[model samples]
Target: MHRSERVSMYGWIWRHLPGNTWVRAGISLVLVLATVFVLFQYVFPWAEPLLPFGDVTVDEGGAGR
Candidate 1:
């Protein structure tokens, strides 16, 4: 509230919390997103499959077909 006291949120986080905690959190998030992306694109797609034989048609009257 006073002009003499400056608020530093970034400094407070790094000072009060363990540095590795932040780093690990960031790494975990990146890994999670990468896994999801890989699964969606290669392992198993949510929208459409990109397998070796291409998207199969189990339902003949599906929207895509």
Candidate 2:
């Protein structure tokens, strides 16, 4: 089968996960939490300086003066 017809990486992981449905759900939740922790602790901080969010502009002394 073609790559597009193949199962997604997430689907493959879910199928390969051990135990029953509840166990898979718990594992999935842990994976999500770990992913989020890594992003906030490392990825976001490293990428913050390269992002345009810090260039925010605000109206001084109220709007429509």
Question: lDDT values of the candidates?
Answer: 0.67, 0.94
Tens digits of per-residue lDDT for model 1, 1-65: 79548868755545565448878577667767998899978766554543456756677787786
| Candidate 1 segments exceeding 4 Å error | 1-19, 45-65
Off by over 4 Å in 2: 1-6, 56-65
What is the lDDT for 35 in model 2?
98
Best by TM-score: 2
How many angstroms is residue 44 displaced in model 1 relative to the true structure, after the best TM-score fit? 1.0
Model 1 residue 10 distance off true place after TM-score fit, in angstroms: 28
RMSD of each: 11.1, 3.0
lDDT of 2 by residue, 2-24 (tens): 97698889999999999999999
Clashes of each: 0, 0
TM-score on alpha carbons, each prediction: 0.40, 0.72
* Prediction 1 global C-alpha lDDT: 0.67
Candidate 1, backbone clash total: 0
